[model samples]
Structure formats: structure tokens, C-alpha cells
Target chain A: MKIVTCIKQTFDTEAKIVVGGDGQISDEGVNMILNPYDEYAVEEAIKTKEKDGGEVVVVTVGGDKAQEALRYSLAMGADRAVLINDPALEKADSHAVSVALAKLLSDKEAGYDVIFAGKEAVDDGAAQVPSRLAAKLDLALANVVVAVELADGKATVTREIDGGTEELEMALPALISAQKGLNEVRYPSLPGIMKAKRKPLDVVSLADLGLSAEDVASKVEMVSAELPPARKAGQKLTGEVDEVVAKLVELLKNEAKVI
Target chain B: MSIVVCAEQRDGKLSKVTFEALSEGKRLAAASGETLKALVIGSGVAACADELKKYGADEIAVADNEALAAYTTETYAAVLAAYIAQESPALVLMGHSTVGRELAARAAGIADCGLVSDCVAIESADGDYLFKHPVYAGKAIGTFKISGATRLATLRPNVFAIEESDGAGAVVDFAPEIPAAKVTVKAVNKVSGDRPELTEADIICSGGRGLGGPEGFKLIEDLADSLGAAVGSSRAAVDAGWREHAAQVGQTGKVVSPNLYIASGISGAIQHLAGMGTSKYIVGINKDGEANIFNVADYGIEGDLNKIIPALVEKLKEA
Candidate 1:
């Protein structure tokens, strides 16, 4: 088995997001980490490689800073990592990113049995890349997958739907987006971190993939970015429990008209 | 050009968000002077076309096929992309659902169009559409414009209102050339619950670690039942094994914007707030007065959830 997992670096889930004056999200003084959901993808890929005896290659598309994410994946047991860094990708949308990834994965020399990615990136929360990539490559895809098993050149995956779970079986060379409840991710050990420093990390650009900036240009443009309006604290009920409950119900029905 | 709404159905019944999307599609089409078309794809979803007509879909297209009985990325995307290729609609709309999130992107990719996911608002300025969506896990909002002939988007559930209007309800039989199945469905385990789905529910009652254990969910469920709300859980509760991951409402879980969100015993971590801060109204019940949940809540009740939840349930039942 040869596995490829796509990962991204995003702001910490708890980071307070601020939009700068230039209509861009300011990453200054913000903590960046591996996207929480992508951690599950990396962990699942490593586990599959450990059990099935294969090479796990992690890939990402971003600027030089994204090398940190690749290094982190390397520490987590990915055999090697590829960072598709390019200045033209600064304003890239999900489509542009997917185009670049499809190009990288389409290389016949680096053929793969399975591809994994986080269900969605926390920063943009687009959740579009993996499906788009799979479509561009004309491969089977399963999103929000929580369980996966492999046998006989095929993969069985259990994914979350609206009201329940669905079990799916796809042939080799399929793509899956990892959802939560998939697996418990392991923290990198000291030895693992040391070994990662020496692991092979390749940095490529759009030109290197035989593509120009125009070819992978973003179809969507961000007009503005701003923080959500602040919510003010409302009435606090601290009186007797029974009276408060009644008052709350009355408020909900009469004032809020929610009930 | 026309505006197309992809209506989703399960067991021949249209999802509530489908109606919402139809309503939005009608408004967009009226604004653009374009036709409003609704597409229903499934094994026995021809009946859904009637429902779409009632909700103001001028043209209802049904792609009834056994191959589309269950959603597979390859088959559904193939059908949708083929439809887009044939119709060449200016805009495509669907619910920001599990299926919609995957299907829209795949279809957009196959059709080589632009897609914006989880849109909360859409505005037209100078004949251009601007999509407003949350970024950084709902902490910030980004206004975007798609630079393409065909633009696709998924509207977040509950953010758009549903309005009924009679249309010509013209039926169009669509023949889709579905590709050979690359993925096969083995089984489906549908959760047996009478409560409304959390994402589509107008009212949601959520519990947290403060409730102590799994037994505490009984109180939450009772409250949810009395108010006809869906049951939700904070990540702590789910992590503690008191609830299913599907019930979790947080950064790593489902993001919901219900009309009313009642959170009990939840401390409202930033991640948790990211999932539900956009709700129209938030009610927090906690023993600690300084829990973060109170900051964003419209109504804060400082008391033990054990006492407040049950009392609220009884009061709601009487009302």
C-alpha cells in the first residue's frame, strides 16, 4: 500500500481572529497548528502504514510557513513530506488548491493506493478540497469517514450522514476525508521529533508541476474579512428556580417568539 | 440562465433545508429575472418534485434512478455535473449538509465551476453576487465573489427562511448518464430517533460536562422533548462518553445556528461557541455565574442544571 495524506496549517481553534485594516485576517501573534481534523488523517495514515506495510507521504500547499505543518506530519510518522509552496497561491481558493494537489498526485511515478485528507480546513471551513481533488482525478471519494478497513485491493469505509452512518466499499486509489471519532492521534515523541529533522522534505512550486499561476488562479475572490459582531450579555435570572423557569418560558414565547 | 436548487430527499421525503434552498432560489431568480428550477435525484423522489413546486420552483426536474437510491460521490456528482452541463445554470444552490458539502464540490469540480460552501448570506450588488460565509471557525466572516459564469454555493441550514408559493410546477424528466459505480454501499445504520436533527432543528437543548455523567443527559433529553427541540452535547460531554459524537456541538463537531439554543451546564469554550454563537438566541443555565457561555447568551440563569432543567421542562410542558 502507498498512502498519501493531505494536511494544512491553520490557526489554533481557540485563537481570537482579528481582521486587519487591509481586509485580511491578521495572523500576527497567532498560534498556528496542524488543523485539528487533519491530525486524525495523519494518525490514520500512519496507523494504516504501520499495519499494512507501506510508505506514508504527506502533502500540503501553502507558503514556506507550511513547512512547519509538513515537519509536524513527519514527526507523526509520515515517511516523507511534500510542500507545494508558491507565491501565486497566496490568494488561492479551494479550487486552486485542489488543482495543484491533483497535479502533484497525478504523477504516474508516485502512484498511490489511497489518499486521505481532513474533512475540512478549520480556517476557511470550505470542506471542498478533497472532493474537488477526487473529482479532478476522477477517483472515488468518501467524506466524513470515521472508520476504514482495507482488503483485496479495495477499501471499506464507514462515514457519517445526516441521521446515521453508511458503510461504503471502494476500489483501490480511492480518497477519504477524515472526520472526528476516526482515531486518537498520538503526540510526537522526542525520538520521533529528532528523526523527523532528518526526514526527506521536498519543496515544489506551481511551475515545477508544469502549471502557471493563471492555470491555478482562484475562481473565488475575498472582498472583505471581518470579525463577527460582538454579542452583549442579556438578562440574568437569579431568583427562585420555579419563578425563573416560568419567566424564562414566558419570555421565550412572548418576547422572543421562539416557542 | 437560471438558478438551480438541488433538493435532497431521503425515503422520498424532502429535507427541510431543501425548502429553504428553494425559497432562496426563488428570490434570486426573481431578482435576476431568471427561471427557478429544482432538481430531485433519487430512487423514488418524483414525489419530491410536487413539494418543490409548492415552494415556488417554476421547473422541477426529477432524475429517478435506482443507482441514485443512496448517495455515492461518483454517481451523484456525475448526475449533478451532467445536469449542470446540460442546464448551464448561472447559480446552483443546495443545503450545507453532509451530502451537499461533498456533492457540490465534486459537481463543481467536474463542471469546472466556482463553488462557495456554507454561505450564510448572499447579496447582489451592481449585478454581482457576494457570498458571506464564516471563516476561522465562525470567529470571522468573509465576503467573497466568484469570478465564473456558473457559481455554486451551499446555504447553511436554518440561516435561510422557507416560504411557500405556488408555481407552474412544470415537471421535466431528466435522463442522467451515471458512470459505473466506483464505490458500493454495504449498509446504512440510521439512527432511530424521533427528535429533529440538530442542524435542521429550530430549537436545540445541549448539555455539558457539568451534568456529571451519561445519566445527566436524561434531564437534557426531557427538556428537549418538552420544547420540541433537538438534543446536543458539548465536546466535553461527548468526550466523556456521555453522548455520541453526532450530538457534539463544537469546533470539531457540527456547527448549528438554530433559532433558539439552550445550553445547560456548558462552560462555553471558544471552540464550542464557534459552533453556535450565530444562533438567534442563546440561553445558558449554569451553576457558575462566570462561565463563558453567559457572555454570549441572551438569557443567563445561575443555578444548578439539575434543578433548572427539570423546572424549565415542567414549565414548558404546561405552557
Candidate 2:
């Protein structure tokens, strides 16, 4: 059973986003880190490998800068890292990226038992690539999984819904997207970080995967970037709690009519 | 050219978002002089065709079967992919929901198509469509164009308006050849509560770290029940373990745009605002008058929420 995990390099969640004069976002002076959600996938992959006596490999689709993200996963106990860095793939939409990933991993011929990824990339919030990749690879897919139980080539997964949970059972060679609370992500030990520097990290391109530019071209083209409309300030209602509630209810009934 | 609107259902009832998708599909189709068709899939859902017809659907395609009663990723995606491959519609649209997010991606893969998810707005010009969606956590917006022959996108709930019109009300049956499902749904653990889903709620009442502890949620729950609103929480409350992460509203959590949003004891962090800023009306209540939440709130009240919430709950009950 070989475990492959997908990771992404994204701007820190708390970083202040700046728009450039080119009408695009400015990543300058912003910290880049592995997507937080993917951290859970990395942890789960390592734990599964430890329990099942297999190897964990981390894969990513981004530019040269994404190598550091893969390194972070390698330090977390993965045995190998693969980076898909092609200028043509920059800022590619989910559809294009997933296709490239499916092609790259399947070409490995490893017969992977499980592929893991963050449910949604925090930067784009697309949340589509894993499922699309599953379709491309013709594997069973489950997203936002909080719990997973593996036994005898079968995987039982529990996904979180709005008000409850949905449990599903699937065969091996499946894809499971990680959500928060799946497991506690462990920091790399000093020795593990040193060992990661020598681990095998391979960089592949469109040519390497035997794919043409048009075959993996992004159908979704980004047009422009803009900020949302700013909210306006409103009057403050000053009074006791009781008076405030009374005034709010009055406003709701007569002014807004939402009640 | 035709636009296929995938109608979603649960427990033999159509989702409200299905109508919203149909309405938008109709408008887009009219702009391009194309046909607008509704595809309703489920068991015993033939009656949904009449409702879709009222929503301006030129034709309705029904795929009713026992195997389609519950949503399975493989079964649903296979069925939809086969339909798309056969009909070759110019565009496919569905709600950006749990099922839609998973199904759209899988279906796109099966057909080797393209998709843009969580679209806030859609526009058509000269047979080409543009989708507006938030990137970088609502700090910036990205407008996308799909040049492929077949395009797919999922619309955010509550963003598109629902419009009704009279149509031919024609019904067509579509039999999808479903392959053996690789996955099986064991059970769905439903939380027994009358509250609406947070993402789909028209009104929301949220709490934050100011609530102090888990017991403080009683105030929010009571007010929410009184107003018939869903309960939400800032990431602070969820991180503090005072509330479940499912109730969290922030950049990493669910993005919701409701008609009215009441924030009790929650300071307006940019991440939290990114989720709920699109709400039509916002009311902020906190002990500090200088909280950033007041900046975007339509109305601000300076006080402790523990006191204000109980008072508001009582008032709402009386109303």
C-alpha cells in the first residue's frame, strides 16, 4: 500500500493581502506556508504508513516556490516528493491541475492504495481538484473526511455535513480529502528535518508526463481582480439591554421586515 | 446550444437551490438564444418536473430510480456524465453544495470538461460566459472565462434570485446507465434540530469568545430559536472549544451571505468578516463600542451579550 498526498503552497491566512498596480494580488512580503488543511493529510499519510508498513509520497502542482512546501511534507516523515512545476501550469484552474496530477501520479506505476489531499485549498477555495482527480484516475472519492478506518483492503470514511455526519464504505485505491480534527499534526523532529534534506525530491514538467500544452490547458481564464464593496457605518443605539432589544425588534418589524 | 440545470433533491423533495439554478439557467439561455432544460434525478421525483416548468424550464429530464434515492459519489457522477456526454449541452449548472461540489468535479472528469465552483455571479455575452468568484478569502475577486465547448459551474446559495415564468412545460425521460457504485452510504447522522442550515439560513445569530464558555451558547441558541435562525460562531469560539467547528464562520470555514446577521460578542476580524460580510444587514452587539464589527454593522449596540441576548430572546418571543 503506497500512500500519496497532495499539498499546496498558499499565503498565510493572517497575512494582509495587497493588490498590485498590475491589478493582481501582491505576494511580496507575505509568508508562504503549506496549506493548513494539507497538514492533516500529511499526518494521516505518515500514520497510515507507520501502521501498514508502506511508504508515503507527497506531490504538488505549482511553480518552483512549491518545492519548499514539499520539503515541509518530507520533513514530516514522507519518503519522497514530486513537484510539477511548469510555467504553463501557473495559476491554472482546478480542472487543469487535477488532470496534470492524475497523469503525473498514474505514470508512476506504483499502484497506490490511497491518495489524500486537503478538502479545499485555502487560497482558491475551489475544493474541486481531489474529486476531479479521482474521476480521472477512476478511483473511489470522499471529501471532508473526519474519520477513516482501514481493514482488509476496505476503507470506511466519515464525512462532516452541515448538521451531522455521513458515513461511507469504499474499496482500496481510493481518494480521501482531509478535514480538520482528523488527527493532530506533529512537528518534524530535529533529526527528521535533517534527514529530509537528503530525501529524493523529483521535479517533473508537462513534457515528462507526456502531455501537450493544449491537452492540459486551463479552460477557466482569470480576467481581473477587484475588492468587494465596502460596508458603511451605521448609527449606534444607546440604551440598556432591555431598551436595545425593544428598539431592535421595532426596527426589525417596521424597518427591515425580515422578522 | 443548451444549458442543463442539474436539479438536486434530498429525501424525495427538491432543494430550493434547484429553482435558483433553473432561474439563472433560463436567463443565460435566453441571452444566448439557447434552450433551458432541467435535469431532476432521484427516486419518485417525477412530480418535480411541473415545478421546474414554472421556473422557466423549456424542458425537464427525469431520471427516477431506487438506486438514485441517496447520493453516492460514483453513481451520481456516472449518471450525470453520461447525460452530458449524450446531450452535449453547452453549459451545466448546479448549486455549490456538498453534493454539487463533489458531483460536478467528478462529472467534469468523466467528460474531461472544465468547471468553476462557488461562483457569486454569472454573465453571458456573445455566447461566452464569465463567472465572478472570491479568491484569497474574499479579499480579492477573480472573474473567469471558460473557452471549452462544454462549461460547468456551481452557483453559491442565496446569491442568485429566483424568477418564475410560463413555459411549454415539456417532460423528457432520461435513463442513465449507472455503473456499480464503488462506495456505499452506511448512514447519515442527522442532528435533530429545527434550525435551518447555516449556509442556507436567511437570518443568522452568531456568538464569539465573548460568550466566555460553552455554557454561554445557551444565550445564542435561545435567541436563534426565537428568531427561527441558524446558530453560527466565530473561529475564536470554535477554537476555544466552546462550540463545534461545524458552527464556525470564517475564511477557513463556511462562507455565508444571509439577509440578516446578528453578531453577539464577536469582534469583526477580517477572516470572520470574509465569511459573513456579504450579508444584507448586519447588527453588532458587544461590550466595547470600538470593536471593528461596528464599522460594517448596520446597527451597533454597546453592552454585554449575556444581558442583551436574553432580553432580545424574550422580545422576539413576544413578537
Candidate 3:
């Protein structure tokens, strides 16, 4: 069995982010890391390989800085890595990115038995890529998969639904997008980190994939970003506990009318 | 110009968001100088057509198909696309719920247009419609202009005010040339949550990691029970495994616009604010006065939630 995982790099959430004078987002010396959701995808991919005895490949479309994200996946125990990097791949929207990936995956080597990705990226929160990719690849796709049992040449998938979950069986060569709490993430040991550097990583530029920068970008561009207006802090309520409670009840019943 | 509003109904009854979308569509139509139209689909569900008219729809397009009895991507999209292409409405509007977000892109895909999902406020500006979307979760705001002539947008429910009437307008039966059997629902599994439906709740009580554990939600539930409010959670609570993601309120979770939002033990992260920041009124209960939740809170209570919430719940019961 062969599995492929899609990953991306995002601002390290722990870092303090700031908006500069030019209205651009600057992390103010904060570090960058692989998206946490994608980490779950990587972990699930590795576990699937361990269960079915297959090779796991981590694919990332990012910049020179993204190499570190690829390295992180390798450190966590992927068998191979592929970087679709180029100056042109920047700011690719969900649709174009899925197209570029589907073209590359289809026209490239190694027929994959399964593909996995996170439900959505933290930055954009556009949960369209996985479904779009599956549509483009013409693969039997399951979006937002929470659990899976790959056996008997078919994968029984458990998907989250309104107030509950559903179970379905799909044949091999399927696509699945993972969500958090699906599996426990493993930390890379010292030896695993060392072995990561020697792991096989194939770096391919966007040009090599026969796609130009425009093919992967949104026809729409984000010219500027700004913050929402903050509401005035509510009048501070102070007194003994009962008094404050009385004030709150008055507000809810009279002023706010929430109750 | 004509506005196409997707009327979302459940079990042959109209969802509140349906009226919200209808209200928004009416507003958009009046703004754009157009007539408001509606599209209804389902199995044995012709009764909802008359109710939709009272909400402001002038012309209602009915597609009675057994396939649409339940929402399946293929069935809904195919029928919706057919209606959209035929009518060529100036804009299409749907409730900015989870199902709305999921279908927005697919609808845009079929229409070959761009979509601005999760829009809080929308209006026409400079001969183009401007969509106000929150960026950086709820920490920021940005305006988007869709160059597409047939604009698509999903508005957050409960944010828009709903107007009711006794007027029932013209109902036209236009059979969508599509078979429902083609799109198999395959299977549906749902969890039965004890909490009131978060999206439909008029008053919401959400807890954060400050609550300490899953047990803290019990106090939240107690308060909510007293107030007849839905229980929700911050991402910290959801990520900490104290609550389900469905109950999460933030940029990554469901965006809510309840009349009243109460945050207990939540420090108010930007991501969490993005989800419920648009509520009509927000009350923050936290020990830290400097907590960001206070920035948008209409009432700030600086205290320990464990001690304060119980007292508040008791007060509500007494009231």
C-alpha cells in the first residue's frame, strides 16, 4: 500500500502576530510551523502505513522556508517527501492549488492507494481543496473523515455528521480529509530527527510541473487587510455580589433583553 | 433584477434561518432595485411554499423531487444550478450555516463565479457589492468585491432581522430536469447532543478553558437551563477536549449571532471572538479585567467563573 499526505506551513500560532504600517501581517519574530491540522493528517498517514505496511510520502507546496515543514514530517517518520516549490506558487487559492496538485499527482509516478489531508487550513479556513482535489483526481473521496478501517481491499470510513457520525465503505484509491482528535500525534525522537535529514526528498519547481504561477493563484488578489472595529467596553458593574447580580438581572431583563 | 434566495427548511417546517435569508434577500432586492424570488425543493414538501411567501418572496420556484428530501451535494447542486442558470438572478443568497458554506463553493463551481462565504454584512458600494468578511478570525475585518456579475454570498443566520407577513405570493411549479435517484445519500449518522441546538438558540452560554474541565460545562448547562439558552464553547475548551467541536464558537467553528452571548471563563481569543463577535450583546465573565473578551463584551464581570457562574445561575432561577 502507498499513501500520500498533503501538508502546509503556517505562522506558528504561539507567536505574537502584528500588522505592519503597510497593512501586511508580520509575526514580529515569531516562528513558523506546520499547520496543526496537517500534522494530524501526517500522523494518520503514518499510522495507516504502519497498519497496512506501506510507504508514506509527504507532499508540500511551499517556499524555501517550507522545506522545514517537509523536514518536520520526515522527522515524524515519513518514507519520502516532495516539495512543489516556486516563486509562483505563492497565494494559490483552493481551486487552483487543487488543480495543480491533481495534475502533478496524475502525471507523476507511484500510483497511490490513498490520499489524506486536514479538514481545513487555519489561515484561510477554506475547506474546499480536499473535495476539489478528489473531484479533479476522480477519486472516491470522503471529506472530513474521523475514523477509518482499511481492509479487504476497501476502506470503511466514519464521517462526522449533524449530532453524530456515519460509517461508509469505499474502495481503494480513495481520498480522505482528517480532523483533529482522530489520532494521537507522535513526537520525533533524536534518532528520527537525524534520520530525517537523509530521507529521500524530491524537489520539483512549478515550472517543471508544466504550470506557470498564474495557474495556481486566485484571479482575485488580497490588496489589503485590516482589523474589525472593537466595541466600546461595557460599563463596568461593581458592588457586592448580590448587587452586581441585581444589576445583571436588570440589564438582561430591561436593557439587553436577552432573557 | 431578481434575487434568488435558497429557502432552508427541515422536516417540512421552515428553519428560522430561512426567514433570515429571506429578510436579507428582501433587503438586497430593495437595495439592488430588484424583486425577491425563492426556490423550494424536497419530497412531499409543497406546504412550505406558502409560508416562504409571507417572509417576502414574490415568486416561488418549486422543484418537488424525492432526491432533495435530504440535502445531498449532487442533488441540491444540480437542481440549484439549473434554477440559477435559467433565472439568471443578479445574486444568490443562503444562510451562512455549515451547509450553506459547504454548498456555496459547489454552487459557485457550477455557476463559474466567485463566492464570499461567512459574510457578516453586505451592501452595494461604488457600483459593486461589497462583502464584509472578518479576517484573522474575528480580530480583523476586510471588504471583498466580487467581479462576477452573478454575485454569490452566504450570510450568517440570526444576524439578520426576520420580518413576517400574511401575504402568500405566486407559486410556480418548475420541474428541475434531474433525477434524485442518481445521487444516493448513501448513509447519514447523527449524534444526539443534550444541549439545545446552538444555531437556533436565542440565548447562548459558552464556556472556555477557564472552566477547568468537562465538568465545568455542567455549570454552564445549569445556567443555560435556567435561562433557556444553548450551551457553547470556545476553541480552547473544544481543543482541550472539554467540549465537542460542534459546540465550538470561533473563527474555525460555527459563526453565531444569537441575541445574547455569555462567555464564562473565556479570556476571549481572537479566533473565538470571530465566531460569536457579531452577537447583539455579549457578556464576559472572567477573573482577568485585561482579557480580550472584554474588548467586545457589552458587560464585563471580573470574577472566578466557578464561584460567579453558580451565583448567576441561582439568580436567574430566582428571577
Q: So what's the TM-score on candidate 2? A: 0.97
- By lDDT, rank the candidates, best first: 1, 2, 3
Query: What value does DockQ give for candidate 1?
Result: 0.86
lDDT string for model 1 (A1-259, tens) is: 8999999999988788878989988999998899988999999999999999999999999988888989999999999999898999998899999999999999732589999999999999999999999999999888999999988898999999998999999888999999999999999999999999999999998889999999898999888998889888889977899999998998899989999
Quick one: best lDDT, which candidate?
1
**Candidates 1 onward: DockQ, in order:** 0.86, 0.78, 0.37
- The CAPRI class of candidate 2 is medium
Please identify which of the two predictions, 1 or 2, would achieve the higher DockQ against the true structure.
1
What is the TM-score (0 to 1) of candidate 3? Answer: 0.87
Query: Candidate 1 chain A — worst ten consecutive residues by lDDT sum?
Result: A102-111
- TM-score, A chain, model 3: 0.91
Q: What are the per-residue Cα lDDT tens digits for candidate 3 across A1-259?
A: 8899988887765454466787756656768788877888899999988888989999877778888988999999999898887777676666667767786788774499889888767665656667557655656656567787788877787766444566666677887778766788898889999999999988898788888776665533444557666677887677767777779889989998878
What is the interface root-mean-square deviation of candidate 1?
A: 1.0
Off by over 4 Å in 3: A15-17, A20-30, A86-88, A138-140, A162-164, A205-207, A211-217, B164-169, B173-195, B209-213, B251-253, B269-271, B287-296, B304-307
**lDDT for each of the candidates?**
0.91, 0.88, 0.76
By descending TM-score, how would the candidates be arranged? 1, 2, 3
lDDT of 2 by residue, B155-261 (tens): 88888888998777699998978778788999999772899988888999999988999998899999888888999999999888898778888897888998899
Judging by DockQ, tell me the better candidate of 2 and 3. Answer: 2
